[model samples]
Target: MRDWFVASRVSAGFIVVLVGYTSSAVIVFQAAAAAGASEQQISSWLWALGVGMGLSSIGLSWYSKKPILTAWSTPGAALLVTSLQGLSINEAIGAFLFSSLLITLSGLSGFIDKLIRWIPQSLASAMLAGVLLQFSLQLFSALESQLILVVAMIACYLIGRHIAPRYVMLLTLLVGCGVAYQLGLLDLSSVSFQLAKPEWVSPDFSWQALIGVGLPLFVVTMASQNMPGIAALHGNGYRPAISPIIAWTGVTGLVLAPFGGFAFNLSAITASICMGKEADSDPSKRYLASIWAGIFYIAIGLLGATVVSLFAAFPQELVTAVAGLALLSTIANSLAGALADAEGREAAICTFLLTASSVSFFGIGSAFWGLSLGMLVHYFTQAVSKKKQLMKT
Candidate 1:
């Protein structure tokens, strides 16, 4: 209804889409390029990913009345950049199918929820804070390169935070664009308006792809993407059924694999924009922002080629500053939640340090390791406490 179409919700949705594309769309393009996709095939990949995220976002938000945002697995895309080498496009599709099947089976088995429940809230929040600390830190590191641009954006953000809090990111983004244009940082000469068409590739299964690409994609998507996503939701005091959402992402990814939707899952960093107070003060109404995100995603799918040029026009510094500014509040909240519990303070700090380090073991990412390590420390501390109590008694 028109009543739900507030300016803040609309702005939040726009910010979510902006962060999604700016953060990792380039990496996704590289993955497709690595898989030997032609221009048309690459366009179809964007089309499939866009459409898959769009429809699933809309449907899930409607069904749950929560701001359930979906995204292409950025970590999975990065994995493909390395693991997908020497694999044919058809074989890559087979790997995608295998990953989706595993995601679906994990959801159906209800094991994911149980595993998530075992993770302490402090540890989860710590991992999210650690994951996001990089972006917030980027704000200052960027000043070294583009002083005026970063300073102006930060000033605008501080001013907007005090005056009109709901539109802080929107205002900051506008200021960044204007400043970038004045500095001659934007390059729009290559920009074009073109609609993308989908091109499907029939899958050819191979055990090599299943082992190399599929397993890695499934693990990273679950560990890196969905884990923080669920943590973000819990940190914000929203608890929806996790299994069904994961299953929907699986089904959606499976449906769009041939068209180049490598993987789809709950978003971590970007979803926080929609889940936070920036989206809407009333949690019940925040779903509207996600609906708007879905609408923008469908438009992005339709205007696939144009998106490439559109995003390219802005300087890299501008994009990084804007995303960092947009997430400042969320990062603050995540860190606060992470350190709130005294019992798990040490464990949480360990998680934060490990995750922020960005170290990886085997094919898995730092988020998983951070959580695993923190949980181990927490259990060890609890056992010690129990033994001490018995000795005292």
Candidate 2:
């Protein structure tokens, strides 16, 4: 039983890494290309990011005894695709360093900590639910193309959950892979055994690069990534001094910035996999998932091209389905948390809908806007109710 439990936790970690890298790695590549990186430099970029996320996720999860997974800022990567177009690789590196420094200072100042504390729990959960809703919908929407593969994986997941809940995700993943392979959907020709060559480029700072790329990168990463990450931790009942963890990620960014590690922040969507009962019936053991994810991150860093090619072989629909099924429980739990309190229900629901809409403004994602709007609704409603009671009395 103990061995089986350990296996489940381990599988959860892999799922987090799998979903994370395959989902946004293309954007990271585009960001690197925009900086005019050579093939070797692009390999270095992946190596730095993979290792940075691995070390931070493992160290933070182990130290905090919580499933605190770190990820490269997807939005930050997208920002770089356009922002770094005219910048030298050295200038791009400078922008990366500047953004990381600001992130570190934000953590040290405890401003972000205060902001997170001000958010209602219901709204936090609502934001999480909203963020994950798209992935869940993708699971079924995939039926249009890979109907047999999707149906088979879903059927397997449902039955496995009833008979062996701990193995459901693992079972679903294996089923998806097996069926996809049988259909010749996987492209295994690119599989190779080679290491990603790491190259270092010293940064040359300029005001234009710093303000245009650095400052905006900092804003988007903090608002779009770290906030939701902390909310995931809180929503799942894991609180371990998020302020310091945020600082640590910034510190990691500072260290790896020159090597092409643009941004490192807490993971919002993927972290839920490790936090839930699917990882371990005992929440305490779920930290192992992050630890394993860290180990995989390091391996992928060392063999960036090789391992990534292996993940790339899996069909897009397969990745989408597995991610949705793995997140099902987390999504359900988040919804329950969001609506659990009558006083905060309106605020939470609004937050959920806005976040699910995938809205963005000023380069900031919907997660931030949803939380902000929800906070306003909650406080305004409470104040109006108080005023009406006073008048009646």
The residue-by-residue lDDT of candidate 2 on 60-125, one tens digit each, is: 988878888999999999999999988999999999999999999998988877887788889999
Model 1: per-residue Cα lDDT over 312-360, one tens digit each: 7888888788778777888888889989988889999999999999998
Residue pairs with backbone atoms closer than 3 Å in model 2 (clashes):
none
Model 2, residue 308: C-alpha shift (Å)? 1.1
Q: What is the Cα-based lDDT of residue 314 in candidate 1?
A: 81
In candidate 1, position 368 carries an lDDT of 88
Instruction: Find the candidate with the highest lDDT and give its number.
Output: 2
lDDT of all predictions: 0.88, 0.92
Each candidate's number of clashing pairs is: 0, 0
> lDDT (0-100) at residue 63 of candidate 1?
93
What's the true lDDT of residue 306 in model 1? 95
In terms of lDDT, model 2 sits at: 0.92
TM-score of 1: 0.97
Clashes of 2: 0
